[model samples]
Target: MTPRLFAALPVPEIFHKEIRRLQKGVPGARWRPSANFHITLRFFGTMDGKQAEDLDAELASIAMPPFDLTLQGSGWFGKLDPHSLWLGLRPSEPLAELNAKCERAARRAGLEADSRKFHPHMTLAYLQGTPIEKLTRFAERTGGFVTEPWRATHFTLYSSQLSRGERNIYEPEADYPLL
Candidate 1:
């Protein structure tokens, strides 16, 4: 079977402790493990070996200088249902350009255009039937969260595997430097 894949910049390990501190206080929230923290550039979905190879070749063609990124604020995706919680990032033009480049690579590899708008963030947790008030309180408490700027040196292609009764496993397939 083909692997589900995505391209993303992994969150630097320096900030994991602080991020972990904010993962609590929301009942029934499936908090993401620190190992899973990343800002996705593109979700490629499931791909055959040929498609994956084409995508890797296309991605390797990307060229850009490294840029700084800062974590800021916190929020949820679904307002009414509150499906997921995330930590936002300070806006950066370089990030947008890299995302666009990834999109172009995907198309060059014969993948369909991604319809979802690019919103740079690191997902904190998955929510299920979480009360709005609890989500609000969690937001209010961590709303002003911010982190020191960190350099993004490279982006990676990762294969995701579903593990029953456990967090999804993400394995890095390849790395593309931003030099």
Candidate 2:
């Protein structure tokens, strides 16, 4: 069997609630639940059972120092305009180091390199029928909004499930504690 999995740093409940609150002001924007908020370190699209098990074992052995992270701004990623709405993560060496550790773990588990630079950000919404004007306006308004900071003590391996709902739901396959 193959499963869609990824490693990420979960956001705290308080910050999650704050993000939901901000979502209220954006017209026609769909919000993701707090439970679905995370800073994705690596995305392993789909892997067989053997590969998954090996990854779990490697992740279990990975070590990382705990760190504090803050969501400092809001932005979007797209060629012509904003496509994906995301909250930018503040600069923290520990956070970057932890991400690197996860990347190493992925390699140790025999996964291929992603080839893309890892920018730490918590995804808030995905653009579907959003117009360019609205996206640009929102980006300009909230580009410097700073959310509260919190300590990150752990990261998890999550399996994503596609649904017809507003946001994608993820299930925790395993969790690894940070040092």
Would you list the C-alpha lDDT of every candidate in the order shown?
0.96, 0.81
Task: Please report the candidate that would top TM-score against the real structure.
Answer: 1
For model 1, the stretches where C-alpha displacement exceeds 4 angstroms are: none
Best by lDDT: 1
CA lDDT for candidate 2: 0.81
Global Cα RMSD, each model: 0.8, 1.9
lDDT of 1 at 79: 85
Q: Over the stretch 1-179, how does candidate 1's per-residue lDDT look in tens digits? A: 45699999999999999999999999989999999999999999998889989999999999999999999999999989889999999999999999999999999999999999999999999999999999999999999999999999999999998888767899999999999
lDDT of 1: 0.96
Model 1 clashing residue pairs (backbone): none
